[model samples]
Target: MANVTFTSPRMQRDLTVYAVAGDTHTLLSVAKKNKVPLESDCENGECGSCLIQVSVLSGKAPVGMALTEKEKTVLRYAGKITQAQIDDAETNDRPPPWRLACQFIVRHEDILVTF
Candidate 1:
């Protein structure tokens, strides 16, 4: 299991939930299930409204999670990530801090999500 903590000024307090590692569920689904108040539109990866900042909290290297092509385009257009960041993520397995919640798959590592 991995601990996913959601934090935002829109919420009264931080909320943390457990998620099964390697599950097909996206972070947006998890947020909906837990009522994390994460704003989203177009559940698909086409919209960038579900953008979030994810930070690994396990005090270790973050697990590599693949970014979908749609996610790359949307994030790039939003200026959330750069070409170099994308290249690094693709080549070095280093994910950029910004991600689309609808495309992010939780790995077996604790993480803090800020929206």
Candidate 2:
């Protein structure tokens, strides 16, 4: 298991990372573990409601794979995240391919900031 870090006004500190971690677990888990005050309107990845800037710090991000049509569009307009910045599993639409925090997954180390 790898360590996941989240830094922001509400939360700061790294927590144990797990695959398939839901939105509530993503923030609530981090907050509970790190003693932070983070809130989630919806647990699911939608509304862009829990949008945050996830600054991943791992060079091992799975990339080079083809992207879905939706992913292609998001990759085109990515601000800090690019198509090359995503991993293969993270490319799937189920958990979301990236763009929103409530969606994207962080396999590598991260310094996520809440916006």
Candidate 3:
């Protein structure tokens, strides 16, 4: 299980919910199950509508999470992330903060999500 906290500035509210995650459970799925009010289109990595900034709250590692190839392309095209950041993540084994919610799988770690 992972604790997923979502904070929406537009709604002026935040919710903390528990998610039972397996290898297939993405953040978007958990959000939908808990009614976190995340706006998403396509429900896949093809569109960038579900882009979110993620932070590690308490985990085995402080790093955020790895970005998928589709996430890298969309976020880069939208200017949400830079190539330099991608390079850093690749070379340093670090995680990028920006991610497509649809593509990010929630592991057994607590995370904070902002959209």
User: Whose TM-score is greatest here?
Assistant: 1
- Per-residue lDDT tens digits for candidate 2, residues 5-115, read 555554354343443332324544454455544455664543344455444445544322233444335434655355444443355522222344444444433434444
CA-lDDT, candidates in order: 0.94, 0.43, 0.84
Candidate 1 C-alpha lDDT tens digits along 92-114: 99999999999999999999999
Residue 62 displacement (Å), model 3: 2.7
Is candidate 1 or 2 superior in TM-score? 1
TM-score of each: 0.98, 0.42, 0.86
In model 2, where do residues sit more than 4 Å from their true spots?
Answer: 11-35, 60-98, 108-115
- The positional error of residue 37 in candidate 3, measured at the CA in angstroms, is 0.9
lDDT measured at residue 8 in model 2 versus the true structure, 0 to 100: 57
Task: Give the range where candidate 3 is weakest over 10 consecutive residues by summed lDDT.
Answer: 58-67
Residue 65, candidate 3: Cα error in Å is 3.9
CA shift of 41, model 3, Å: 0.7
Top candidate on lDDT is 1
lDDT of 3 by residue, 15-102 (tens): 9998775558788988898878888999879899998988888846644457788889999999988998998888886677888889
Looking at model 1, the pairs that clash are none
Give the clashing residue pairs of candidate 2, or none.
none
